[model samples]
Target: MNILITGSTGMVGKNLINHNNAKEYSISGPSSKEINLLDKSKILDWLAKNPTDLIIHCAGLVGGIQANINNQSGFLFNNLQMGINLIDAAYKSGIRNFINLGSSCIYPKNISNEIDESMLLSGKLEETNEGYAIAKISVAKYCQFLSEKGFNYKTIIPCNIYGKYDDFSETGSHMIPGVIARMHKAKINNDNYIEIWGDGKARREFMYAEDLADAIWFCVKNIKQIPKFINVGIGEDFSIKDYYQTISEIVGFKGEFKFNRTKPVGMKRKLICSKIINQLGWMPKFSLNKGISYTYNYYTKEIQN
Candidate 1:
């Protein structure tokens, strides 16, 4: 099988490429420099030449809270355009198998318990990242629309993910990487205190990037018919305080942290309801601590080089 993976250098796409062990499939991952996702002509041309039997669409404009607030239009436009172009191109190319990635942020902001796939679009999105979530929701709807016409598009929604190749930007990264980056920099600079936003009570469920990749591959190889939307995660969560403590220990940061109550905590809790996906016999292999340790080691090596 010939497969094409967009966003090849991204956290999720990189893990997907690295962990794919199916000897029967040939995967092609294209970088942004090679094909601009916003350019429909380029996408069409690339697909015409690539001759892929399957396409894994992981490319998107993504970042943390600050970036999302500052670049709302950019997030919405770029992500929506990319999804529309790729799915249309795949449709034109007659590729039957396509996987669309969605964010758990697509859920409503007030959800504090386990989130099931049925809860999507039931309420308003979190205002901070509403633009990005709208784009993702649109893509999922489009896929659903196309499925009725005989297209085999699968949408997998994952909770907050972290691991190697994550964007560690201090101002524009997700929770795990952002915390690690700040704490690591503080430790390296011999800073005495690391400030955390909120009261450290916000809890989140995070799946390692490799585990998400593994889930995707498992879907590709084992499942005969992928659901319209499925949740992939570890099915458990921990408080922000625990995450900080764990990551700080892994990075050897001895300093304490001060929580700023004025800043946003994003969500109170984000646990994945993995009943459907779990029934498929898919389970995450990495524990929170183990994943953090692995990611910290990679981050340290990266900074030294």
Candidate 2:
């Protein structure tokens, strides 16, 4: 099974490649020179030329809350184009077995504990990431529509994935990497306190990237009885304040946290339930502490250089 992955350098894509099973899988991680996603001609041409059996789309302009707020147009346009182009090309070229990865941000902001797959598009999305959320919704629905039309494709909505290969840059990284970077920088600079956004009251679900990869492989291998769209998460959540405290402790950031009430937190609470995926015998195995520590080490060792 030769799998085509677009965003090989991203956090999730990096974990998907670095896993031991990935070495066994016939996977191709083409650099930008191979196929620019926005270049429709290039993407279609590449699909027609390359004989790929599967396409695990991991590309797009992804960022955290602040990044989303700053670059709404880029997020919406890039993600929409990437999703539309990849799926259209793959479908037209007669390639099936597609796996589209979407964010939990697609869920409505007010969704309470254990968000089901059906709750999508039911309410207003978090304003901070509304553009990104809308783009993700389109992608997910695109896959779902194709699935309904008898395409052998699936979409996995993972919640707040973080691990090795994550962007440690403060401005563009997600919560986990961003927090780790902040903690590391604070520790190095001997800063007194760390600033958190939106009062640190919101809750979120997180899954290790490696665990997400495991779940992806599990779904790919067992596509039988799979839903058109499924939620991939740890089935648990933690408040942002608690998450910051944990990361601070792991990175040895001995400082107080200052919450800025003026900033806008994306979702009040978002955690996806894996009842559908779990019933098929797939599960994620990483505690918040362990994943944060592993990711912190990776960022400090590989990225901080």
Candidate 3:
């Protein structure tokens, strides 16, 4: 099948493109400069010329907690606009298969339990990333509305992901990559200590990006059987301190970590229920340590050099 993966240069998109099964189909991964999703006309024009049969919508404005807090408006507006434009263009172009990527952040903030797909928007979102969550929820709802009308658009909500091509910048990266970068720098500079935001007690479920790519491909092969919304995750979680310890081990950082209680830790816990996807015969291949090791290796080889 002919497939178009938005945000092809992103960590997730790049992983999907590099998946072994990707060779079985014709896939187009256009850069933002090649096809700007913020513009509807540009999307429609691209579809008109590309003749795509499926779309894996992975494009969005995403970042860590500080970035989310500082750029709430940009996150909401850009993400919402990009999703709407792409989905609308896909509809107009008669494309039936679409796989929209959603984050675990879409679940309510107060729920400390393993989040299921049904609990989406059940309560207030965590204040730190509420804008981004709202945008993701809105787009997922849009896809659901279209799915009810017979289109095969579906949303796959994955937990925190880190792997090759992850954003490891100081202010623009998620927990895993951010920690990796910080710890690596501290190790390199022979810093005696590293500071962690919050009390380092909040829990999170993170999967390797390549594992998410495998799940997406599984969804592609079983598109008709996939639900309107499904959760794809590692079915496990770790405290911030635990993650710090693990990543430190991988990065060979021997420094002590100090916690800053004043920093905003978005949610106390955000672990999603991956029962449906699990039953669908899809499971993540990497453990937390294993994934971090791979990601750290990628960091050293790709980003550090």
Candidate 4:
């Protein structure tokens, strides 16, 4: 099968392209300067280059809460344009098997702590990333509409992804990567304290990016009637305060972290109630501590090597 992935340079995409265990498939992404999702015409032209059988829509404008707040227009516009353009082009080109990547933030704020797929669009989203959330929701709707029209597309929403090849760059990284960078710097400098956002009361669910890649390939290979949409997560819950302690331990930063109440602490916690995928006999294998350790080791060696 010929496969294409978008957002190939980002954390999730980088991990997926490298971790995909599927052997007999051809894979391509944006880094080759082949497909720029921002330009609709470019999307069409790129799609024509290959009679691809499948597309992993992993491309989008994504970042931490700060980036979302500081660049709402760019976040919302670019991501919306990319999703609509690519999905429509895939449909027009007769590529039925498309995967629309989504985020857990699309779920409503009042969603039960352990959120479910059915809870989407049931309430308002967290305001900090509402624009980004709406774009993801649109993709979900687009996939469902296409499926109803007899197209075979699927949208899989993942929560708090982390692991190898994360963007440690100052502007692009998310919470996990951000924390890793901060804690690592602190460790190197022998600092005594790290600063975190809000009251450190918020909870989040995290999955290693490689484990998510595994789940994606599993879905592609095993499921025929891809439930239109599904949730991907570790089915575990953790708080930011606990996370800081964990990262501190992993990086050996014996410092205390101050909770900055002024900053936004997205949702209290977002644990995807992925009973559907779990019932299909899939579960995340990496614990947060171990995943953090490996990620730290990666950046450490990246600096050393």
Q: Write the per-residue lDDT of candidate 1 for residues 1-305, one digit (tens) a residue.
A: 89898998899998988884645589898889788888878988998888888888999999988788888898999899999988988887788888899999999887877999999988878888888999999998888888778878889999889999998876768889888888888888999999988999988898889899999898777534668899999989999999999998888899888989999778688787988988888889999999999888888788546
Best by lDDT: 3
lDDT of 2 by residue, 1-305 (tens): 88998899777788888887787678888887889998778988987777899999888898888888888888999999989988988888888789999888888878776788898888888888888889989988988888887887888889888898887786888888888887888899999998998899899888889999898878778765788888898888999999999998899999899999988887788888889888888878899899988988888788877
- Measured with C-alpha atoms, the lDDT of residue 152 in candidate 3 is 98
Residue-wise C-alpha lDDT for candidate 3, range 42-117, written one tens digit per residue: 9999999998989999999999999999999999999999999999999888999999999988888868788999
**Structural RMSD, model 2:** 1.2
Cα TM-score of candidate 1: 0.96
Which is better, 1 or 4, measured by lDDT? 1
Worst 10 residues of 3 by lDDT: 104-113
In candidate 3, which residue ranges exceed 4 Å CA deviation?
none
**Candidate 4, lDDT over the whole model:** 0.84
